[model samples]
Target: MIVTAKQASSHCGGHPAMNSAKPTLPAQILSQTPSTSSITDRLWRHSLYNVLDQQPLDRVNVLGDNSHGHLSCVNTLSWTPDGQMLLSGGDDRTIWRMDPDYDVDYPFVCKSVIQTGHKANIFNAHLLPHSTRIVSVAGDNQVRVFEAAAALAHSQSEPETTYSIDQLDCRVLRCHTNRVKRIVTEDSPDLFLTVAEDGSVRQHDLRVSHTCGPGGSCPAPLIKCQHELSALALSPLSPYQFVVAGESPYGYLFDRRNTGRSFDEEWGSLPPTSGPSIATCVRRFGRKTKPRDDVYGTHITGARMSSHNGHEVLLSYSGDAVYLYSTRDNPQDEDEHHGSSIIPSSQEHRTDVIPIASDESHIDVQLAETNDNEASSPLQRATADQGDLDGSDSDDLTLDAMPWDDPSVPIILPRRRFAGAGNVETVKDVNFLGPEDEFVTSGSDDGNFFIWHKATGELHGIYEGDGSVVNVIEGHPFLPLIAISGIDSTVKLFAPVNHRSEFSRIDKQEDIIRSNSRGSGQLMTRGQLALIRAALSGQELSEGNPCNVQ
Candidate 1:
């Protein structure tokens, strides 16, 4: 997050470029073109998603495999305000913090197992709507609240450090009746939601004086939906409007002020079923209405919205396929989470809310420091960094393949801090890409970069790729560039080639469109021609002899 120049290189042992003097903005905004573009980093063979960012991007962040301790898969990721530290949760049922400091000889190498409470794979980890405290859910059917003070409060000298993720671990909040598949926060820090495998969704209000703190009882949820909830998220645009992903392959979006059952329950909800391969339940976000109608019950295995960006767009990823839709168009299924609901008690359905408490202090102490050296290093350094693959090839000989090629990785979860009208965007299982507005990008199982349209569900541009799937994709906000990790074991940067001259193409396209449009048809198909004339009519493009043909 904080990029500095080589002010004092010797004093800080880091890559020369690592010490950037300062984040320098271009004297003039640059232009972008498909051909004449500039790219910065390439995470080859590391690409896990098939999505990518727009022009002028930077590899501001990078998260590697476990350095503190190894985990099966990374299921959740969250960023700090400064964008410096990244938090993650996964199948290992462990949580961690990743600080990408290029100055350090090795990054992600200096990590801490962090919260050590959940007994099973951590289904989700998140920061409260407006505060620093994080909430994590697990398959163990428990939910725990972890305040930041507790994480940074660790002192090996203290008694808490005795437990380790690898050794005798304990610590974490466990308050749920079934496997917590996912969790999400609402507009107020006190308000949040979590879904479990037990076919239910619980809404929690810190104000609810439940014994969470002598704070009375965490009020019985304002609502409860009896559908088996899988994934959960609060709409970035309108906080009250939230989304939930479930086991039925479809998710739901309902206004907090609306009905008792969530969209998932109303649409021929499925009976709780068990499976080994169903990691996706149903997730949705993005509040901006779209130009078209999204057929109800869109069976999206996975969905994510763009952060801070204005277009309330969401992407849905199914298997090898991906679909993009806007919040407006998907109205039939566009219900709001006014609150949660409760199903009446029945012989088979009657279940008591089971709450368990784990010793989190223990998981943190034992996980200790990273056991291996620089495991974060590229696969090329295999001699020093071996495992996962058994070939005797040296690290240098091993190509960093695209991470998305594998069916295991997840669609990075979006952030909850940003508040604005968002365009709903969804993608089923398109390997890479998180739910941020501007800096978000994704790589597909097929080799291509699905650059998002700033705030809309449109494609900014497309980047061809290697034969393997594409995954690891990221972008920096301060600079005009991005990086992608692919199956080729390489990271590629996409930058603007002719920063100044590329603007010329925009003018060229406008001119071409002005020469073609005669009238608006029954349904105006969005295109270059429509946009050019619209801009000209609005007098926003400039007065003189418009985009000159010559």
Candidate 2:
């Protein structure tokens, strides 16, 4: 049931056309029109979900293994900070490493295998910063650290047709007791953190291990700021404070330095609880509050505190309204500052947005507007709601939260205005363009991908996502373009030959523009090469990489 029709259809000939009992497209189709019995042709209905008609597509790579097909992609991914290799784990309970730089046949080599064996696929994997070690949490209620260099060395040292899963060193970390839904690490080399389905954030300090004995234990957490939470981000700003924003009504702020540790002999059987700081933070503050309204709320899928520059911090969250939080430094007096607003303002938002009732803050919403609403492209909208952001308390725990910068600092608004570039008018998975600010990409439920520019928010390209949700999209580092992965288990590479950067002559300008903008979607596959490479060269890639890569 987790696989979409788009994925299913990739194996069959046509899309698994929706049954539409009353012309009802199955839940798998992306943006849909509410069906009425009067609708007749079943074939025409497929047009609405026709991914090929919508977005740009180029090349595809296939993945295969001895997997009994029980393993499925968990749909989450992370790249080494170096951006050289990509990592993916799935419902199959294993983590995979792919090299976009290679040809499709050898596009990726299996870098590591996590056999800590959770009941479900591994959800997320984080390659630690400044280190080759890897940390990940899976549907199995465990977070683990695997020695990357050791695995790579072992795999390289071997000469067999296949590497044994038994040879990998995966430690079943007993930190989170719930499904390890997502994991994020500090850009710093020493620490790593994880969050679970139960909504708790746990920090792991790797230093204490060096001091312990053969029969000894590692250091206990420096601090655990407890909240029913989902995702957390260590501020990219110099202050080094981290925030976890999710299902919880309020976010937690931790000064990493305040998270000092003590050794615990009973740590093995210790149940995961709100960390030691819970009592202190909650006692000083009031009971937890709910998140903002629907336009500003939803189970937040992702969030990042952007230093966009060292002078200011803007926290942009994606859910309903794409929110931007701005904060700045004050020199007059440390405490002489104040923040704008923590609540949503109706004036700055689209009137068409149905603001959730103030009291009913959290509700799983089902849409009622499929008949008349329709907009495929982003339209720029203006606003005067400047400096509206959540500020910090100038109190004790916080002032020490970031000694590098004052805790109460609020960012001053720059006159550089931002017009709201509209949205898809449909649910889509938001993805990061590369850090270089070249492009931002997202995929809709219907297997379509949209690429948007970072500054002006103008959409660069829209393409059909094969027949599966475009779960992951990455840019090729050495070349001019991109690589895409989907729920259908196919990966592809893409490029832009029509760029102005490479050409000086304006020959056939109009024809070139039209082709790149709206070319007939074609896919190139080299899966057979992949199989041969894995077979002859003994790379981690299995002969399975050569599937029907349509």
Candidate 3:
């Protein structure tokens, strides 16, 4: 079912609006004179309404323990359906349900903590919609569902309750062979989707028994990508469609209906088969400037479909800038136009396809050999062509001079490009912000949240979030508040407030972009980066007692 804005707003509490009630003046003023009191009350009410209409874009609160909350970095933050609490998962193999209580000095308070019984770090976690169950994925290559009703009930009765996986009713599904990277829930609480580094995308149904699968395991994957998968996003407009991105530079759109099973049919089937029923790729998204042979440092870190516009998709690329793409045509029409799978195969000669934003930009892709002797990296070469880092020189190669610039080369570019955010060393998530999803926001390796105007691609604002890298930036379901987390143990909250301490704004956009471009070429492993981060944090380490950097 297509989810409308009104339905979404209703699901969350309705968005804050102006109260029609007139403000009451002080008793002393009311007793002194009726005319003065009446004018003062109307003016106060008008002023309050104006403030509520403005955007809430200021850092207001930090949520975590005074010493340290999670022993490691927090990876993800998700808001509950009612927007009353936030669910956060981290490398410490723990999930905290926090209440943003404005009544206290420390507004963000952890009401409960769930110790996930995973063998490794927790990657992502979320409270499923229309249900009280919480689904989580971690480095253990398994999906776990926690019956959170009891835990949540305990927390409401007595705050700060701690529950172990064994203490609560839970189910674990061993489906993936490698680390699971992401999970997304559907409209129905029974169905959900997960993607892993094993290159498998699988759908799970809580109502089905797994006895039919091989060795009594979960069902087979619907899509086995050639590249390791990292991110997944379900379309709000289309129930059976979703998008997936990974180590490859491009994002692939797939339709589950192509498997010959409708949503209703899949739900009605009592026993599921063990055989794999794969979906079809409908479209591919990528930049026109990307090189044919160079896939290094081009892996997508995050992919999100805009709730305000399903035709638009936002992507964050490691060692690069954020991009916004517009799927200009219907999925069925594009599927027929492309007429073939965009998946990479072992064949030496194959057609490379990309989504065309408009009819005027249509182009066919032909295989072309890249120069192996080029010393500079793809990022450096692209930046150098614009000019020197200082923006002065001109003799560099132009887009028309590039090998992929031929008329036969298939190329599609992004609708908007947002720069000035550092994404060189970490896997960061990008998202749309504001009540209407009017702004694009992402966290940087520099520990700051960067926002840009979605329509114009102009930098809007930047706020400090964490001490190291800010990996996640999630907007409130209906309100203007935002929750951000990173290498730090705490989650920082941003909202519109009348009073805030003065902070510096970044004015060196070109410098940040250049630095990110240089760092992208010198990438480091996650383990290595973790070690450096620990050292910078002044943690004590020894040969036998090393920090759990994972």
Candidate 4:
């Protein structure tokens, strides 16, 4: 599985002595040409040889009950800290633990099922770090933290369904007033954050009892918003900062250091001590078409802190796009500001604060319609340069925002329309993969998981799923594996082709072969690229058009 350059050269007969003879320039070109013109540098760099050589992936096994998985869409998945087992929950209102290392013959069976005390569909589930405990939030508007069951002892008898209620204790915390959308944990297992459809963000301490008062007042939210909040992500590096994106196009950043004030009071011209609001700085993405339309009005499905940069965020929109945004140039960047800094405004702030659009033609119309005062609104004060279409800022835009038409906004770079093959049109969430965050992955409505190179936006290849709309996908923090779920009742696991090929083989011939016309054959799990490289360097290449190295 570990391929080295020396091995590749040896397989190709690429010894220095082989090329010592001075050959004609034309012969050299012919010798170096690849037989498959489609093989380009984009395919080979930073990925496995099988993937680079266009070998399609094979499904090793399915995880479910009686060959059928979750009864409803498996909306979310998370891995145990050890990565040996996974925690999956969704519309089924039940959570289950799956062992990725189970034998191929019984690969799909659940190790145990947690009888989530949830009355409605489960939205997300997470295994607490360094413990045999798990916490889940769902449409029932409750957060339940419970101890997970021990692994079933090996037996000659068939495995029995283990229940959370029988083996472990459970604590249900009534925090949010509406359906909880997402939950994120930081350094402490007892302290975590949750966001709800009611547009409220609350922090809960497990040590505190929910029923402190006679009427049983719910946990107080650290911040509240008017718009329905769909997603929330706490910064991994900074303990006090977090970001929330929702139906509105603007993604707001909050600092716990300055809690107890509303966003408007802190960022707006209102007094700093304004009542009942969370004072925070907000960043807007995209532009409004009409004068009165909400600025950066696109609904954001999800947002997360970038592992690469603490100040940057990855946001998924309601449309077929995602944006990597930087918040380095806030008006509140003064040293005195302990929390979210405010972006200072001026006379030029309005006319210069243009929306990031892809089409240049709209620039003229946008400029014409935008007046000096219009650009100076509270939202325009914090316009960080819309990094180029790829979301990488060129030298940093103190105030320059990128146009919406830029190519880097979507899952694919260079601006290609999404070829979604299933019932869903928009992705619900996306996350970075690997320790370096080398790739970005999202679940598609078409029941497939899509992965793209983070830097170049190159299509890494699709992971197939059962025929159901996939809503959420997450990567193991350190492993090469990914867990995805959607309308199907089961959560599916995917790993690199090389790794899966070593574990199991599907007996059905049709399942072994990829349906895609290109690279349609049994995929090579090991070092097949050395053979391809050897063939290209030897005299076996086609004689025609050697000069065309593209």
Candidate 5:
């Protein structure tokens, strides 16, 4: 069962109970008592101790309001390396640095606000690791860098004061021709990467002017994809390897070392003699067919590498489902010619647009088959074939031996499918939670966030996060805390509290999965999304309102 703030408060009379007290390690467990269990068993036991403590029902603080907080929907929420400060970017074109441990009546308070000069919505903003510098991207197709200290210094007298882009030390880099979707930092503090709707993945070097290449001439991108990209994930274990997915049914893994000059550099330019810059591996989950214009369930919204297991990946599909896959197996073992670089052919470029059922009937049939083959227990089911979980198939392909034009590359299936999370209405984020990264969590369009056991794929908890939709689910770097934001103007922080009841697990899995699949037919256009943002910001729609369908 999902619990909201109003329902929780009503359960304890008219007054809401004080639920800010944090949980502590039991004395017996802290004493290091001898146990016969193996090291792995003990470690797993300890990690799962308070894994479900962070619940949205017990909201510790709400960080936005009409007067001081963001006037629009908060799109991104991230924590500094030190975990002392939280940063949030929104449609309001502002980035706010928040202190979650403030001493005032409210625990979370906006310490500083950077009013960016981007002509469009701020998609993402994050502080550079171990530095005061901040990087942000927006729909204006520009990447901006500013100093957090400068924003704070300017707002010292008035915490709620907004620091305009001109007043603060900032650098605006106009690199991509289209809107930038995501930006990620590498191990180097001076290096960062961005993917844009222009189908280019470019790397930026902070040490140089114009960020990449030389002077002001248009620098070539590292990799120019055939389709517009929306998601990018750098592998935690390999510095040169990353995953890029968007507008496509598959996620491509590429190595930066193998990248050649941008395809846009010269028309009909031949690939390097060494090899074409192509994905080393490709991952496909769900049905192998092209989605119709009305249903974009196959396009990837986000991709993330597991913090603990680099070979493991989590992908969230637009208006569809979430999947977890492993890339540990070598495709070369199956075929001698695997892993060779071949130019994509025209035939390979054309994806088969296989039509599917219009409603939940198809999903019901898939779910029924899944239940028929269920394992004896949750643990056994997790180890069993993952294809049945989402009622969708999975495949992994190594691209070395096949030409890019080949319709078939390779096929490894996903290890797990996180079910019952509805993501049909909005773009949501999926992430791993807990100290050991033992739990998988995602924001849903139903205004609640869902949590699953990382290893078992069991639906563990579902907590109400927003009144409309929950889009971002960011866990604190070290602490047992979670920060969530979506259509609501405020960012909600969740932490463990004693008064909250244990999380209610879903018993009827089929019902929830069916509910999640029911809305797959509805399509949310870009104009509709903008209207939602405008309504949240209390702004009147005018001739300037975006009307394009995504």
Candidate 6:
């Protein structure tokens, strides 16, 4: 069902008559009104409307192992500050380092591995912004730090030797009671924050010994919630502020400066009663579902602050949507302070409190009329009536009770105007592309890397990735290159091509994962090699990277 450009042109043969042995004109083409009822045809047209005219990703290199990289899911991917190396962790219970390989035809080679410190699946991995230290959290309820330079120095020079547990310079800390879901870092290499399945957020000081054998002391928890958390991000501007998303309906904001209690007391301090000063903001995306149904409501996959603007919060959800919410002072702030809004008995609000449909339609009109870069977002329109004020005390206002009015509603940004690849998977993460944050990109479960125009809310591009779910898409810190990883276990990089010769053709998935009476094999099978040779000798070839099976 997947048709490449070359196949379409050849099959059409300039006219429909080429396929008609009788050479008759189709009456349907000449009909006055279209009467198409085919669902497949309708779906194709719908998808075309959503697809933006943009460049597709070229195959760079695949990195993984049984013999190739990890033999399981590559759950997390991060780039070093220098952009010369990539870091990854997953179900394999090991950390991998993939560096550019200039000597080989492939763009990257994976050799360095850190296998100790974690005994279960790693959920998050990060390279400290300006340092060689790498921090990771996993299901083992531990947060571990590895010095990359130390590993490289101690590792055997033999290129084929796989670095194992005994070789890594790893420091382990037992912080959470359950699986640590994420780790967010500040500007300093020694300071970082972690959130876990046990609903506790703890701040760690790496200068102190993490091991409890002698002088080691456990760090205190920073913020603890009533439910397990799923995602976490620190504010780009404020060192003491951060956001945490969990199974609860709301994503809570926490300020470490306000907490003055010990671990046991702090963990029991519920907000509005004892910890309101520490818990600054409580925001929800879209409509407010009932307390019993909040668990089933839009489960947030990732919650992040814009790197360039701390006021803007970006949240990606399981419902195939991304929302932008603001944290500045508004008229609603006054209402909460004055206690004027009615207290709903069951935390239900008008279903239309978050006006996404109308706001999106309004944005569509504005885009067509002005085409201005400063087009106001849906958040602006939905909150326009709420009088705005300087965000002077935005950080100080804390309601004593969960506000009857939905804590904060999201301004829904339109997504997937074009037909999505499929609903097989939801996007787990989204990141800003380029320095200006002009474009947004995310990995889909459907084996596609999706890009969106930040201001216009248009689906800008859909790049082909691994044949299976693409779990991660991270743009290089300071380079134009983008790294993508997913079900294939290979970390593929995409960068702008400077010349046509740089475009090396990759074979399609059918050729790579081919099944036969003799069993399946990959990478340019004899039949595929013959086809390539025939094409080089004058046969027409298919468009796009051949390795793409989606």
* Model 6 clashes, total count: 11
lDDT of 2 by residue, 196-262 (tens): 6555565667653422223334333323322224555544444455545443223334455543333
lDDT of model number 3: 0.61
Task: Estimate the TM-score of every prediction.
Answer: 0.46, 0.54, 0.71, 0.60, 0.71, 0.61
Deviation from native of the Cα of residue 443 in model 5, angstroms: 1.2
Off by over 4 Å in 5: 1-57, 102-106, 152-158, 211-215, 259-297, 331-411, 501-513, 521-550
- Model 2, residue 381: C-alpha shift (Å): 8.5
Candidate-wise lDDT, in order: 0.36, 0.38, 0.61, 0.49, 0.59, 0.50
lDDT per residue as tens, model 5, 1-550: 0001110111111122245454332212312333423686446444644645443335555665555577778888877755556788888888877653222222456656777887898877777765668889989998888865665443323434467767767888787878898888876667888888876677777775533223444445666665567787775577577777776556666566644445643665432322223333343332222211222224677888765667777888776567776666443232221222232343443332223334423321121123465566543443343443332321222111111212444444355667567777777778888766688888877777888888777777777778888899988655556788999888776655556533322444445455555554354444334444565566764432111111
**Candidate 6, TM-score vs. the true structure?**
0.61
**Tens digit of per-residue lDDT, candidate 1, span 31-102:** 211221123212221121122332332222233322323235445555443334445566665665443333
Q: What is the per-residue lDDT of model 3 for residues 114-173, given as tens digits with 9 covering 90 to 100?
A: 887888878889888888788889898978888887665543334366788778788888
Scored by Cα lDDT, where does model 5 land? 0.59
Better of 5 and 6 by TM-score: 5
Collision count for each candidate, in order: 152, 20, 2, 31, 10, 11
How far is each candidate from the true structure, as Cα RMSD in Å? 22.9, 19.3, 13.6, 20.2, 10.8, 21.0
Q: Rank the candidates by lDDT, best first.
A: 3, 5, 6, 4, 2, 1
Query: RMSD (Cα, Å) of candidate 6?
Result: 21.0
The regions of model 6 sitting more than 4 angstroms off are: 1-56, 101-106, 129-131, 153-160, 210-217, 260-279, 282-297, 329-347, 350-427, 498-550
Candidate 1 accuracy as TM-score? 0.46
